[model samples]
Target: LDFSIDELAGNVATGADTLSIALCKVSAPTKEPWLTLSYDEWICVLKGRVLVHHAEGTLEAKAGETIFVSKGERFRPEFPDAGTEYLPVCLPAFRPDRCIREDESDATVGQQVNDMHAKLQVAEVLYHMCSKEDWEKSKADNAAYFPPMFDKDGFTHATSVPSLLLTVANNFYQS
Candidate 1:
C-alpha cells in the first residue's frame, strides 16, 4: 500500500473494529488533540521518545517501550525531545466510527508520562511476532483469533507428556 502524510490529519490513530497499521514518524513541537472510542491502542516505540497524556496519568515513552491507551480517554501524544518513530496497534482495530476527539484547547498540558506496565513490552513483542501474520490474514478472512488469558499450568488440567526429550531440546535451543 502507498503512504502519504495529510496536513489535515490529527496525527493520531482513531478507529473502531478496524485495524490500521502505519509506521509513524513523530517530530518535536508536535502536539495534536485527539481521542478514540471504538478501540484501544498498544503503541510500540521503535525509536526516539514521545509523551502521552491520558486521564489516568501522563507518560514518557522512549525507544523499546510500548504503551497502551484505552478507549474513550481524552489524550494527546507529543514529542518534546527530538522526534520519535513507532508502531501503533489498535485493539479491534482503529476505525473512525469509534474515535472521539476533543477540542484543541482541551488538550492536556505539561503532563508527565507514567507507564504502569512496562514488563508487558516483552510479551507484546512476542505476541505480535507470533500473531501478526495471523491477525493480518484473519482480518482479510473475517476470522477471529485471540490470545489465551491464562497459562495452561495455572488454569487447565494437567496432561502427561509422551516425551520430555522434545521439551528439553526446544528449551536448550531457545536458551
Candidate 2:
C-alpha cells in the first residue's frame, strides 16, 4: 500500500492485523514531521538523503542506511535538504491500538527504547533477507551511496547454510 505521513493521519483505510510494505518516494523539499507508530517499522533508504530523528539521536541515512522504529516512539523522517526514497515495512499491521501520538510528556519511556531496538533488529533482518550474492552486488553498485561500514561480513558471520537455504526456499516459493 502506498503511504505518506499525511495519508496515515488522514481518514485513509488501513488494516489491523495485516502487514504492509511500501516503497516511499519522498520528493525534494519535503520533510515530514514527527509521528509515532503503532506497530514496529523497518526503514531503508533506497534513494537520496534522509534524516531520522528519535530520542536516541538523529540518524543521517543514505541509500544503504537501514533503520528501525519501535512501536509508539515519537519519530519522523526528514529530507535533510535533499529528496529521498525509502522502503518501509510495518509488522502486526499498523493498527490504531498500536500507536500513540506524539506528546511532550508521555510516560512510556522504557517501552519506547525496547521498541526502537526491536525495529532496528527487524530492519537488519530484512536487509539480509536477499541472497548474499545479491546483497553483495547491490552493496558494490551502491558503494558510493552507502554508509562507510556497509559490508556483507555480518551476513556471513550470522547466517548458517541451513538458515540460508530455508530463506532461499521461502523466497523462491513466495515469489
The whole-model lDDT of each prediction reads 0.52, 0.54
Each candidate's clash count: 13, 3
lDDT of 1 by residue, 49-117 (tens): 778987777898889998888766678777665456777676654434456655466333212111111
Deviation from native of the Cα of residue 42 in model 1, angstroms:
0.5
The lDDT of model 1 is: 0.52
Tell me the TM-score of model 1.
Answer: 0.47
Badly placed stretches (over 4 Å) of model 1 are 1-18, 105-175
Q: Looking at model 1, which ten-residue stretch has the lowest summed lDDT?
A: 112-121
Q: Tens-digit lDDT track for model 2 on 1-175? A: 1123322321122321346555566544455446777778888788876778888889887788788888778886667544567777777554334565543453233243234334222222322234566668767888523322247422222222334555644653352
Top model number, TM-score:
1
- Work out the TM-score per prediction: 0.47, 0.46
The per-residue C-alpha lDDT of model 1 at residue 41 equals: 80
